[model samples]
Target chain A: MIFKIAWRNIWRSKLRSFTVMGSVIIGVWSLSFMLAFFAGFIEAYVSSAIENDLSHIQLHHPDFKKDKEVQYRLKDIEAIEKQVTSLDAVKAYTVRSLNNGMLATATGSRGVQIRGVLPEKEAAITNLDQKITTGVYFDATQKRNPILVSKRLAEKLNLSLKSKVVLTFQQANGALTSAAFKIIGLYQTGNAIFENLNVYIRQEDLSRLMGETAMIHELALLLNKKDAIEATQHYLSQHNDSTQVLVENYQQISPDVNLYESQMSVATYIMIVIIMLALIFGIINTMLMAVLERTRELGMLMAVGMNRSKVFLMIILETILLGVIAAPIGLVLGFLTNAYFGSYGIDLSSYSEGMEKFGLSDVVYTHMQTADYLLIMIAVAITAILGALYPAFKAIRLKPVEAIRKI
Target chain B: MKEVIKVQAIKKTYNAESIPVHALRGVDLSIQQGEFTALVGPSGSGKTTLLNIIGGLDAATEGSVLIDQQNISQLTDSQLIDFRKEHIGFVFQAYNLIPVLTAKENVEFVMLLQGKSQAERDARVKDLLGAVGLSEQIDRRPNQLSGGQQQRVAVARALASKPKFVLADEPTANLDSKSTADLLDIMAKLNREENITFLFSTHDQRVIDRAQRIVTLEDGAIISDEQNAIGS
Candidate 1:
């Protein structure tokens, strides 16, 4: 009955109730939308890096991860492959040799990152084979040098299907070596960083270029669960004798990962502070006014045998009611805001040059996440109830007889 | 006769702007159960202040008020609330019913606060509202009711707690002659029929004339303590 009375009191002055509710709704919506954007964007970024660029984990010589220069190569690849593939967590593995080389065809020549990989095994680990256009992917069962390169790289080399290209690089022994490979296919991967220079050939061709039979510079492993990369990596590193496991997907391992995470963390904290301040002030003002107006009412309640603490509880319940009324609406508004902006995106056409000056990406869009809405809704509910507590306490502490006399 | 209220030399002082305002000056009074007593005085004679002290709304500066021999001044604030809930009923001149509540709700609020079961509150509120001639107006808010109707609801609220005594602080002051007469008749009848004690502080002639005993005050001091040998 007390709850009913308090609930009805809010509607008795509908404007006051709505004003407080509106503030909470707006605060919750904006805060949730921002959190959603951060979470969603980070998810997208990691997926892009993992699937598009780096595999989930890599196995190489102990010094290879530290130096990253192509000095480390495994001579006995079959032994390492058998042990790694036996693990249930390893979805697939690819042998890759990252080499610095110059590509030449009739039309042009450019320095490129020449990746020597087993086409079938690389297909399972990396998205490169799936990106191949214009011709078939390289068949590992076939003869010598069958290479795949990006459309941009192939275009720069002026190579078509079955067109021959020369790749020149220095071997591990510091001897200059050159090879000719048929351009069986071309790929147009969207990343400009790799698209301009990325080229692929068979591992055998790379071994011959390095003048070391069956040598691999890097062994990259893919996993079904990206989150379990650390566990899988730890197990692989401890169990393996010759190979050192570098535990990272490209997305997880990026140098910019901390920068992005910290940026997101700071943004979330600021947004919460701004939102909670506004909401707290909003609820506190409403409840204070409610307290002042209900002075005599509260006193009357005390006169009727209500404990002062119970009176406070009743008022706090009213604030909780306000939060309840507003939170679902706020969640919907947040979702709508995120969906609208996430899809259509906020165009920075006017500030493109300004953004370029800062070197940030082109557009700003608010993507959605469940965690975002959850955090804001919880905060909204808590803040609303908390904001009412002091005023409620004040109202309940009033002297019943004095209050009755004053009115 | 059951001793309903015994006030012993109650004193109350207020400090307004650093000046001591003595509102009650050692007023001692008592009334039996089922007695209708009127406490009358002009404005600022501390008539209302005396009523507030007895109502457990204000703490007496010195001395004690014993209702049913329970020392009210000694009770904590919460205990005082419980005392008010269990033993005291208050009717205010402004007809101080909760304005947002319906006539029935205002009456039922007392029992609700007392932690009375729903059936009990419902039964008492309905009976009391009917007794105050407000059964039909039970659904209306204070604004929707006339001044007379609002005061009737306040009376019903007082009675709903079934306290040993009902204290009216000029409960009929804002009423017209007809409503005032009607309210006094109901209270007077309830006193006789239910053995419920009634006390009032009023200059209103109807209330004083209706009283079985009259205690008069002037300048925070009681001047006349007279009981009509022949009752109204």
Candidate 2:
């Protein structure tokens, strides 16, 4: 009966009820979209890190990680690759010999990490072949040394496709070595930090030039299922000769990616709290007015035998019903907006230059977890209950004799 | 007959700090079961104050009000509300039917508070609304009804809970002559047929003339209490 009365009472002032409900609808919609937008940004950043340089997991000579010396190479690269590849969790793997080198053109020279990679394996792991913007990824027909340089690096060095550059570095015997390589491909990974430092070359050519027949400094692994990354990393760490090799996951390899990943949920909660706090004041104001306008009616209700608790419950129920009615409309609005933007993505090309500085794509696809949607609904419900308390208390505090005369 | 309402030297003072205005001054009154009585007085004579104290709507400053042998003054605020719900029904001068509810729903509201079953509430609402000559107006909200019709709905609501008595304060003050007569006839019939007690505070001569007993007040004190051999 109290529910029936309360339900009917809200309609007595239809415009006021609609106004409060409309605010709730707008609040929920904007909060959801905002959370989704931030989630997309974080997703783009983390995945770009994984795709560009940080594979799901990596292995290196324990000494090579501290000092990039060419002598600290994996002893039996073939055996380690064989063991890791047999595991079903290992989707693809690449072996790389890294050296700190300087790339000098007729214009200038800059320090870079010259990565020695097998073209086919590197393509599968980093998708480097697909990111080429100017030329083919490491042409097999060429007799000269072919290399891949990021578009940003190429532009900095004033080099283009088919341009010749000399890479100067130390050999395995600590002798100075220099090899001239042609830029076969110019690629852009949308990562300013990676673009500024790293360049790719064929492992065979680098090994021959450094006077070593077989050299491997790093092993990068991609997983079939990302959720199994921890299990695979644990397995690889235990299976390998722990005294020589160190296994590190993507997060360990790049701490910035880890920070971006963990902060997504925290950012969502902060957004919800901010939006709900604003909504709380609006709801409190609306409910307070509702209670004040019905002072006489509420007193008569109490005088006719409705207890204080019932009156309090009636007021709370009215506020909750407003949220209950508005939430679905907001959720649907948010869902439709996310759905449309999730598939096609929101174009941010006009700001691509700024976005690339943070390794974010120009087109961001909004993504939200199921748990976040549920959490938002629960948050709105709790917010509605909190907003009702002061107004409900004011309603139950009315003295019947005085309130009845309030006309 | 058992005494349904008893008051002994009940005193009510408002704003007792700077200047005390006594609304009820040592007033003693009693009414037995099944009595249709009127509390009549001129303006500022404390008839409404006495009615409020007896109805448990306001507390007396010095003395206690006992209803059906229970000392209402001794009850806590929550207990007093429950007591009023169980033992007293109110008909306000403004016909304060819950504006959101229809006439039928207004009458059923008290029974809902009592936690009565659906069948009992339905039966009593039909009987009371029919008895008040508002059977045709049951589906109409208070705002849709005339002032007299709204008061009739209030009357039906008052009796729906089958309380010990009905307390009406100027129930007919906003009514025309015909409406007042019609309302008086309904109260008289309900009292005669069902033995329901009624107590009203009024300045209307028509209401005073129809009461079986009349208690008149002067200067916050009851001056006369009389039983009439003839009443409308």
Residues B1-232 of candidate 2 have per-residue lDDT tens digits of 9999999999999999979998888999999999999999999999888888888889999998889889999987788888888899899999988988999999999898999999999899999989999899899999999998999999989898889999999999999999999999999999999999999999999899999999999889999999966765
Candidate 1 global Cα RMSD: 4.7
* Cα lDDT over the full model 2: 0.90
lDDT string, candidate 2, A32-144, tens digits: 78888788878888888988999999999888878999998888888888889789998899999889999999999999999999999999999999999999987578676
Which model scores highest in lDDT?
Answer: 2
Q: List the DockQ of the predictions in order.
A: 0.60, 0.83
Question: Looking at candidate 1, what is the lDDT of residue A316?
Answer: 91
C-alpha RMSD values across all candidates = 4.7, 1.5
Per-model TM values vs. the true structure: 0.84, 0.97
Clashing pairs in 1: A401-B57
Each candidate's clash count: 1, 0
For candidate 1, give the lDDT of residue A377. 73
lDDT of each: 0.79, 0.90
